[model samples]
Every structure is written in C-alpha cells, then in structure tokens.
Target: MTIDSDADADRERLRELIDELAVVRGRVTLSSGREADYYIDLRRITLHHEASRLVGRVMLRMLDEAGIGCAAVGGLTMGADPVATAIMHAAGAEDRAVDAFVVRKAQKSYGMGRQVEGPSVEGRRVVVLEDTSTTGGSALTAVEGVRAAGGEVEAVAVLVDRDTGAAEHIRETAGVPYLYAYSKSDFGLE
Candidate 1:
C-alpha cells in the first residue's frame, strides 16, 4: 500500500531527527540483551517538539495502513508517553478521537491501585506503542498488562527496530504483529 504524502514526509522527518539525535557507533549492550553497533536514543527525539510531532503522524499512518481499530494507544510508561500524546492530538486533528494511556512499571501503591492508567480499556481496541524495541520484553509487558485489563491489542509499533530479533520474538511469543518506522539498515548503520 502507498503511504500518503503527508505521512511520508512525517516519516522522513522523523528519520532525519533520529539520525541527528541517536548515537551511531561501536558495539553496545541494549536493554533487549543484544549487541548493536548503533543505538537510537528515542528519548532524545521524543523530547523534541518537531520530532515528537513527526513520530505521532507516522504512527497514526501506520495504524491506518494496518487497518487496526484502536480506541486507545499506550505502552510501558516513559518511552510511550510522548508518542501516545502526539498520536491522540494527531487523531483529533483528523476528527478521529483516541485516548492515551500509560502502563506503569509497577502497580500503584494506593487509590484504585491500577497498573494501566488514563482510561478504562476494557472492551476497547488498543494499540501498544514503544519508542524502540530490542528484545521486545518491555513492549510485551505492556501488551500483557493491557490484555489483563481486557483491552484487545490489535498490534504493537515501535519507532526503531535495532535488528536484534525483537520483532520476531514479539510475533512468536505475543502473537501480535510488530511494526517499526525505521531499522538499523535504514539509518546506514547496518
């Protein structure tokens, strides 16, 4: 399928931002437990205004292409927060409303004592997003949390794939198709 011009532009802009902010160098250990010569510090981009907007647009386009219905978008906190906020804003601009959520690393110590915060996902179609995926463990943790809360996760999307086999691992273990906007090869690090 063809990507719309606006979406393509957004994706390209995000690529450029990643190239500027993410470190490209020698071997390094990633959270995914894999070795990589380059690392995409997605936090760097997510914290930047333009980069965050581009990410939101790209992710929305990807969700449209996948034909996945989602009422809410979220993932393991911190990394997914900015993307989810951007997505919610972008979707609203398009007249398609979507809620954003955050899955805490640990259950809250008080109140409702919830792990997934923001809105009730029960019976809603949700998409769990991540800034980067290396081993896919963190993303899966969010997915499982969403599932346990009764949200049907249609898929998972990450900003970068380090080519560390995380995508395959997610597909096999979680049974959810993993999507990424860029890969190591795309950044000329492969």
Candidate 2:
C-alpha cells in the first residue's frame, strides 16, 4: 500500500482497537469532576505494541495535518513518554526527524534541577502530547515547562478526551488548539 493508504489503514485500525479496548461505563468521576458516564483509559491500548504503533501513525498524521513545525514532541512524563516515543519512532521510519522531551511533575533536586529533560527545547517548536486529558492540568503543566525552557508550543494532542472541557480549557488558558484521537462517543459511551 502507498504511504497515505497505510497511514489511513493504521488510523482506522487504531480507532477500532480503541473502541474494543475502551471500557464504557457510568459513575466514573473524571479528573474534571463533572461525573462522566464513561471513560477512555488509553493506557489500556497505549501499553500494547500494536496499538502503540497505530497510535503513532495517527499522531503523525495529525502533525502533518496541523502543518506545525515541531522540533520535539513531548509532555508530562510517564503517560506521555510512550506516546512520544512511538511518535518519534514513526517519524524516524518516515524519514522525518524530531526530538522528544519529558517534563517532570517536580523539578529534580539534583541533575541541573531540570524540569524538562532530553533534547534542549530552547527556541524550538514543540507539540505537547498526552495519553488522556480531563481537566488538561497535566498537559498545561507540561506546556508551562516547555515555555519556561524556551520551547514554543505549537499545539497539544491527546489520545482520548473525557469530555471534561479540557479542550476548551486549554484553548482559553493557554491559547493553543487541542486535538484528540477519540472521544467518549467513539467508544459508544456517549
């Protein structure tokens, strides 16, 4: 298949896998505390190899669509780590090079007192990524770290949005567009 066709297939497969893996239920108190009837725990799929590959494809497609020049793809550590690694690998496979950074929840007491690790982001374009977003606080925290380190955040992307107004919050607070691969409706929860 052509590259475009392959990317499309990957995106479709990723969506299908997400639909299958996501648990749809009621009474889940989301991070936003709006009482969501469903949740998309992307970690269920993100930790799986096949799902991670598909997710990487989808993210790369999004980056291309956004037309933003990203020097690095990163966000708050732990959850964002694997997703960022997948995107970086996919970019390498596609012959597009991009760096990845990690933002710690707390500044390290040692080792240069670093909050953002990996490639230095100074004066470079960046895209903050997350596995899931509810209130968008964690993602915004990473954005703040990137900015403090002199990285220009071009956009933010999440694997799933829990319908907690995070997208709007990020837009209003950070003035950056937020994108999601799937929502509660995609998993038949809405």
Candidate 3:
C-alpha cells in the first residue's frame, strides 16, 4: 500500500531512527541461520521510547492504508512483543479497536497449555507483526499458531524487509500478503 505524504515524514523518521539506532555492523548469525555483514537489530528501536512510538504510529498507518481491518495485532514473542504493544497503544490513542497476542515457540506444558497467548484468537482476523524478517519463519510460525487457535491470518506485517526471500517465502507458504514498512534501501543498506 502507498503511504500518504503525511506518513512519509513518519516513515522517514523511522528510517532515520533505524539507521541511527538499529543498524549493527559486524558478522552475525540471524534467526534464519543466515550470516549477515550487518544486522538490523530492531529491538534497539522497537524498544526505544521515541522510536517505539514511531513504530506504532507508522505501522498502524501502514495497516490502515492497506485496508486490513483486524481485531488484533501480534506475532511470535520477543521480537514481536514490543511491536505489537506499540501498535495496540497507537490504535487505542486513535480509538481503533485492536488487541495483541503472543505466539509461543511451543505450547506450555503447564498453565493453560496454550501456544497462543493473550486475547483469544479463536475466529478473529489478525495481522502478525515482526520486527524484521530474513526467512519469514518467525512470522509464519506465528501464523500457524494463530490458525491452530482458530484465528484467520489476514497478513504478515513486518517493521522491515531484509530483501531476502522472506516476502516471497511468506506469500507462497502462507497464501497471504506480506507487508513491511521499509527495505534495505531505506537505510542505504542495499
């Protein structure tokens, strides 16, 4: 979806914040098991006070502009945790109805024995959020978890796209649109 000009500044600000706070130059092994010269450690921004606020606002605009209405926003834990909360709070400030959920790696052996936590995903449309994606495995896993809990997977929304195969991989594998706010060029990484 095309973000309007008003959001252009917000998206640009987020790109700048990512360049300043999230980019890490060094050899690193990604969650996708791929080696990278630099890592977009988005938690640096996703958890940052100012940057997190931008994340919420920009991501919410992205979703809204895409016309993806949903009852909840969330994805796999850790990376998706703050991002989801950011969107939830942002939507609330705008008086939009949105909840958040966490997808556990595996169902807890105890407690409610649930793999998906927070507001029940049963019979609701949801957009999964991820800080960044290389293989799209995390977001796809969240999709499976949500489906298992009876939620309709609307789309997979990522804060950044690595220009890797994740986008294509997610679309082919999950049969849903994969949306992202920025790409490598946004931070001059490409």
Name the candidate that leads on lDDT. Answer: 3
- Flag the better candidate by TM-score, 1 or 3: 3
lDDT of 1 by residue, 17-38 (tens): 8898875677788776677777
Compared with the true structure, what per-residue lDDT tens digits does model 2 show for residues 117-187? Answer: 99999999999999988889999999999999999999999987777789999999899989887776676
Q: lDDT of candidate 2 vs native?
A: 0.85
Q: What are the per-model numbers of colliding residue pairs?
A: 0, 0, 0
Q: Write the per-residue lDDT of candidate 3 for residues 137-160, one digit (tens) a residue.
A: 999999999999999999999999
Looking at model 1, the pairs that clash are none
Q: Cα miss at 146, model 2 (Å)?
A: 0.7
C-alpha lDDT of all candidate models, in order: 0.86, 0.85, 0.92
RMSD of each: 2.2, 1.6, 2.3
Which ten contiguous residues of candidate 1 have the minimum total lDDT? 1-10
Candidate 2 residues lying further than 4 Å off, grouped into runs, are 24-26, 32-34
Full candidate order by lDDT, most accurate first: 3, 1, 2
How far is 88's C-alpha from truth in model 3 (Å)? 0.3
- Global Cα lDDT for candidate 3: 0.92
Best by TM-score: 3
RMSD of 1: 2.2
